[model samples]
Target: MSGGDEQDGPKHEEEGKREQVTVVVLGDLGHSPRMNYHALSLSREGYEVNLVGYTGSKPQIEVLNDEHITLRYMRPPPNLSSLPRLIAFFVKVLWQAFFLFFTLLTGPCNKALLLQNPPGVPAMPVCWLYCFLTRTRFLVDWHNYGYSILALSLRKSHPLVYIYRMIERTFGRLAHGGLCVTKAMKIDLQQNWGITKVTVLYDRPAERFHPLTLEEKHNFLLKLSSQYPCFSSDSPDKTAFTERYADGRLALCEDRPALLVSSTSWTEDEDFSILFHALQDYENVRHQFPDHYPPLIVVVTGKGPLKVHYTSLVADRQWSHVVLLTPWMTAEDYPKLLASADLGVCLHFSSSGLDLPMKVVDMFGSGLPVAAIYYPALPELVKHNENGLIFKTKEELANLLQDWFRGFPQETEIKETYYDFYKNIDEFRKLQWHSCWTCNALPLFSYGKQKHAKE
Candidate 1:
């Protein structure tokens, strides 16, 4: 779906016209939060943003009611019966890239083309060619290295893997500027690939995510139970699961149940098994403390190829305490659910060691302390026992849960610690969002420099 105020020909510097930026992502727009943020932020900042992406269902032509932004979606290709699966995948990618190239080339010349990487193999080269031909500024936002993720399925020594790596590095260098999600990734790109114009842009959650009031929490819980009958209080073990106090106290409060929320993409890179095993361990450990309430565990995930397999595993295990909600939620309900949660768990281990998870950022925005699975790049965001807890093993995760459930003698002190951490995160998020465009992208691209100069 693509329709917007199209220029009759190539747009020139007409007086009082806003600069145009075409933000392209080969992935689904609904799933790509970083690209969504980019398009929204640019549109908010007085730039005309044409967001190009793929939509599985209906195309979303407008987002956030911003007139300056237009979303253009490409429907995925049908399955090919003759060619090998891998070859078929590339064929689809090539077809999509060709369409994207023509779409951008005909729209407006001399505008910035901001592309999201990972699917970079098909997108970067096409974007680079467009930029080269039209004198457009091509910039890449590296969420993760596409080659490293592909290497997870194919051996690094494979010819396809080697070609993917070469394409990424070559096109990445040719781009005018690049933005990465982590400092480690920035360092890697600078030292290994010699991409000097890269900058680190940490992910930030939308402003809607924040701590909910008690009434709001209750309303959200009611809505959740009504939407998903499995979470209703009519369940047999209703009395066993009561809401624990939110002020760092494990004591059962009223009818409200302690909420444990997790958002995952349900991919191979994310080790959900660790979370499942840890939940099992916590179940056994919780029995030891009868006075404590059994928390409600909600694992929110999008439907993927492994969804059925994981759902079957959960059913087979009969984790009565846990609820696995599949598919995506509406924008309004998602943050409401997130903000109402007592704690958030992140199980993403980056396919590339340098990448970070955006789910954690969203959790933090809601003032929810997280228990994140440790990865090489995680420490930069999650400070162990400070803003949040980080664990490398299932045992450690169980122990953390045990501590959370086992009320401390100095409950007030513990609450203070959490409050201090929340304050730190709030301050950090403010600073990050305030300087997001200026510090991260501005000095690298020519248009960014012009914007900065105007400011």
Candidate 2:
């Protein structure tokens, strides 16, 4: 049966057939949508899942216990600054690794999935050592092109890049299987690092992201528009809703075009500046084609010290075009909010390699057209001029927006292609996407062996 129907069957029989396996999830569970989905999916399958993550407003036990899984949260250190935070992260990882060692020694763990974080490579050698000694299979969840991410983000090359590459190589060599999020990453592992056991597991739309009812979609858009400053609120007497900026800089309006919105966590390495700069160049799209220009709003969502600083950049540029939703948002509300958007944007600088970003899947689930940088993995999803537009430079954006402003003369055809792509996703090659945890990593039950079963 297809994955579309995969979740329906074997629900009642799942508990009876549940496997006794312990999976220690090590990462920022609060921020990790993929981790949450995988853990929840495993629990639904009645697996004995255990998670080790950070303490946050979101209850650790709340999410897992709801799914009949056990959870343990590591208390964060006192320091809140970046440097202190890094040090704290290292300490926490070490503590978790040691805890995992004990857990493996005392209890039973079938697999250990390590969601890697930068600067935590040092602990990997030790983790691998434990995995080797204990006979517990290890899965290194490779999120991106490590060398490329390092090359783009770090100010100085130093030995850190080489060190990271070395650790990754070692981990790739030692790992029972390397869980990559995209085909490009799998290829990178095999060709660059010479590791064979690589699997492509991408961010598939969770059950939560299924198509919403028309009323639900409409209601969600209502709330989003009402709360947003750009959308009108004070004048309830107004006959029709109008879109205008607070500065009155944006007066031109057209058919309430499908909204293009995006939200993401701010990482020091991510080049959102490139996106913001491109938006500035695309201003003419909003001016000339008031009918087709999306909300001309870019929403920055997620918590970070740089939020205020980044918003200031938007405000300083008089980019009334952007909004900052930096505070916490409910998971239930996230998909609806995203779905309300007409388009989605995921752009990174040239230094960023071809690893699939989580936002791409989020946008796909939202069913919005995408506009992104011409990176490797994204092109797999975004067939230029078909589902989305890829800009090599800000100048290219101006040209694209100009065409878009012309009522997206090709909007209907383009949107249909995008819809078909998302609907018939499985028909495509399985090169870019991987099967969550089970497919990529070899189970601890089968060490020193290799086999495959149809999913």
Candidate 3:
């Protein structure tokens, strides 16, 4: 998952020649595609990439070891098992801060690249002060602008919301450059914090993910169909791939109503329970719309602990309309899985705007329409009925699904505007150099984006 072209590496060094540049990246790593991709790419580009992150239960040493990247993991203390979540958060902040200080004191100490994480609210003051004192170049990679998500999560007047806003503003003011996940996010920054000259680098799909060959597609489908017999019409696995789609394939049936769910992290928050229940309601009234029955299928992918938070819902209700898959399949399988789906679902209860999620790009990349529940920064990529749909309620969502099923949803054709923004990652790599800033003679890229600020 991590090798790059050997020629991409830094130039050969003569004896006693000091390292050209040292770039330290602190980013969220637990199930993070951005951090992993950025770290690997930066290292390949000849920078001494030092990445500090958390890799969940199974560490990702292979990536670091292969790319010649230095990794500092924030493994939780064994004794803190009882209070792992809170304790881990504290430890991670301390660890990152410690290293930030360490690098500043001993290493080349020229530029610092930071990915937003918790304690950002607290870390901003210290970071601003650190750069002010040391004169080190401070570049804030506003991967997901922290305040925007917090503001959405906590209504405006809440005390914590106010505190988060303060921190976000301060960080924006202090940062030499800002990076946002989407165009909308950049616009938000300009209007809110007055931070211009921002760069937009999307969460591009990894190099490992590419178009599948015809033979590869056949083998992929055969294995997937065999593994989940439900996908096979001849075999009675009770998963009802037909209900997921009448013809049972993305390309087979045109205008067939379908639902696609892309989950990167296994969490109960996406509210598939509500979605399932709503689908059941549709099933109950199938007789009314015999000619207009829209098939509903839910496809899920990603590796992690096997979990169905809505176990009770699945056992009691008929998920015969649902198709469930695991994290094992190759990324190539995703486009095919989604190609058949007419509507893609990206719903989350968490207010973390820091990530717009890679699945969003996959949905667009597959050319399938999307239905999102107003996840921050997502609107930047998905602009209501232009590319896909965005809804905020059970009734609104159900109605939207029903309408899409009935083939009367707003847009005549799904727009691929955002997809153009991510067509080739080479563009981003090029932009990185274009946006690079000189700090103590080191060329550092400040990935910043701009947008009209929203209060």
Give the number of the best model, judged by lDDT: 1
Shift of residue 19 alpha carbon in model 2, Å = 3.8
TM-score of each: 0.86, 0.75, 0.67
Model 3, global lDDT: 0.53
Q: Residue 393 error for model 3, in Å?
A: 3.0
- Candidates' RMSD to native: 5.4, 6.8, 8.0
Higher-TM-score candidate of 2 and 3: 2
Candidate with the greatest TM-score versus the true structure: 1
Colliding pairs, model 2: 200-433, 200-434, 201-434, 202-434, 259-342
lDDT of 3 by residue, 1-455 (tens): 36645764454223332232233334445455555655555555445555655445332444545545666554432344566654664665565666555544554443455545343654566566666776755666666545545566456687766777777777777777656566766777788778885666666544333344434444454556667654455533222233223454332224333555555445444556556555666665443674565455556565433245554455566545444444444544556766545566776554555356567666555555567777656665667755667777766776766666553122323534434423432233233321232221123342211122221
lDDT of 2 by residue, 60-98 (tens): 233544544556664443443556744764675566667
Q: Write the residue-wise lDDT of candidate 1 on 276-351 in tens digits.
A: 7777776665566645545455646555566677778878877555555664776677777777666788988887
Query: What is the TM-score ranking, best to worst?
Result: 1, 2, 3
User: lDDT of each structure?
Assistant: 0.73, 0.56, 0.53
lDDT, candidate 3, at 403:
63
Candidates 1 and 3 compared: the better one by lDDT is 1
